[model samples]
Target: MLPRARPTRVVRMPDTSRLDGMTSTVTTPSSESVPRSHPADRTGAQVAADAAAVIGSADLSEAGLRRFLHGLPGVDRVGADGRAAHLGTRSIKTTAKAWALDLTISMVDLTTLEGADTPGKVRSLVAKARTPEPGDPTCPRPAAVCVYGDMVAEARDAVGNSGIRVAAVATAFPSGRAGRQVRLADTRDAVAAGADEIDMVIDRGAFLSGGFRKVYDDIVAVREVCHDAEHPAHLKVILETGELATYDNVRRASWLAMLAGADFIKTSTGKVSPAATLPVTVIMLEAVRDFLATTGVQVGVKPAGGIRTAKDAIKYLVSVNEVAGEPWLDPDYFRFGASSLLNDVLLQRQKLATGAYSGPDYVTID
Candidate 1:
């Protein structure tokens, strides 16, 4: 009887070390909204008492929790441009189904993404990404292009006619440390410019500070604001696993975000170092799997940043295929947040079909 869903607290970097072995606690009665406790404020004794209270009253069954999560509000904005759109048009459904893509965070490490890698540059990169190659068995394009909020419009425009949906990062990306007004405005602006989906960062500092309510409120507000926009942006809450070190903490954040209203739960902004490792993606996808099974809702997963080569993308794909099975293999439920990975994947694909080391551009994929 507990209230359906609750928002999760943000996890800050400075406090991540503290949660290395210990995770925050949520306490709630069976028929009431879950009350989240910030361990940072309460004395050790008080914190332990709250933890015991939560453990005592709440129904911790994953099945029931997942069902409730699946029932949350939000439009399922699956684009027609994914494998569904591409191969369907060609009248060869199997070719489109033959390939799946990673929903990347799309930031390059060699350059300063904010300045040198301006919105225009990002847009250009996106353009190259949407162009299909001659060797493509079905001539199908990638599912989506993910970028910073400022470039969402540019990306949409650049990928025009290619049928790729543009995804924008919001909520003060890389650090969810902005004022509520600022965060809402960012979401509004991104959606206004035609972003189909949003990748938002959670305030890790607040979560670490035991500011669960503050963090939850902020994410919920963004979720609401994102939903209000014309484009009906999909919200992807980034847990910033590098900032949240423990597997338990990652699991907790995954559930909390799912409960809060995340259509997708992604890792890292691709701006932070050590972004998107397999272990973390595994943990998050596991949460996605459980959340889906229990709730009957399908949520997407994006492992952003640090995935540069085809091999890395393949490894991630292999892992997802192994752990989550074929249902989760579609671009709808799986994605990789990479900027430089497409070319390699295409190059490898071409080589596999025709044994020749083609020029970087010969692959016809950017």
Candidate 2:
């Protein structure tokens, strides 16, 4: 039987009592009260101009690594897993557009969303989700249709009975430049309108501008808005790794986000030039691993944007399995925030199962 769609509800913030034992305190970012250890605090437009002055400038030795790693609740370094050789076969077979997608593409003004060629582009994307043409063999079904605040109800209505999730980018998406009350209100509104998961963009600007405290406080406030029991929408925090730059910086962002109550730590906003890449994902996964060990809180990791093939997804899977150990392999712990790449994964799955390559409709993710 197909999994029944979990109904969306009005999400309430976690109780203050639950906050008693948590490791880190979420703080608002400012010049005076910056977050404790996130290196993203060092990146900004002006700083990027001084790349030559920044490259390999900071100490990244083993001691530096241990200092950051040991701060998390449950972090420990594993020598090497003998299962490292199993990194190659990471593909999932399905059609690209038919499966699911987290339409949380916040890098641009989605209100001016391009490619809405048909009358109901969002509806069409929802309707055509289960159908495919003969010639389109490489596409895979998107996991969900992600959208921002206002469209949650529309997306929910469009995807009715399809058993697909309608995710909304919330907590002041993209820029996350809103005030705390506004951000929390946005999250509450999205959930009430039937959004399944909340994809939040971290305040990269604040984190990069020596305002980690603000960034942390923002995430906690947003998280509070969505922590209800019945309609519990998971939170995915986008780090905008491209803007942050450097593997070490990515690692620090991951730790900070995970510590700040993010259920999943994601890579980019798709608007940024660098987007999601290999090294950034590696760092994020390792951060998740260490955080899980320390705090015993197993958060998820998502690599969004710029992924387009089965091979790419497989590499990410390999990286997760390699760096994070075997326990983090499930979709609950890992997700791909992609729209263009699911088809290639499906095509490859078709070839592996059937001797001959087939068209898009040949496979179904359900």
All-Cα superposition RMSD per candidate:
12.9, 14.5
Put down candidate 2 lDDT per residue, 1-366, tens digits, no spaces.
Answer: 333222121212222221111212322122232212221222222122221111212222333333443333322112112122234344544543223222211111112123333336666556545443234544333556666667778778887876667777876667677777888888999988888778888887777765655665676666666665257677788899888855545766776676567778889767677888766676676666554443345677888778877666666666665666555655567777766564555565456556687676664332
lDDT of 1 by residue, 226-259 (tens): 7766667777888898887555566667766765
| lDDT of residue 102 for candidate 2 | 20
Q: Each candidate's TM vs. the true structure?
A: 0.69, 0.65
TM-score (C-alpha, index-matched) for candidate 2:
0.65
**How much RMSD separates candidate 1 from the native structure?**
12.9
Candidate-wise lDDT, in order: 0.58, 0.57
Model 1, position 110: C-alpha lDDT score: 14
Give the poorly placed runs of model 1, Cα more than 4 Å off: 1-113, 134-137, 359-366
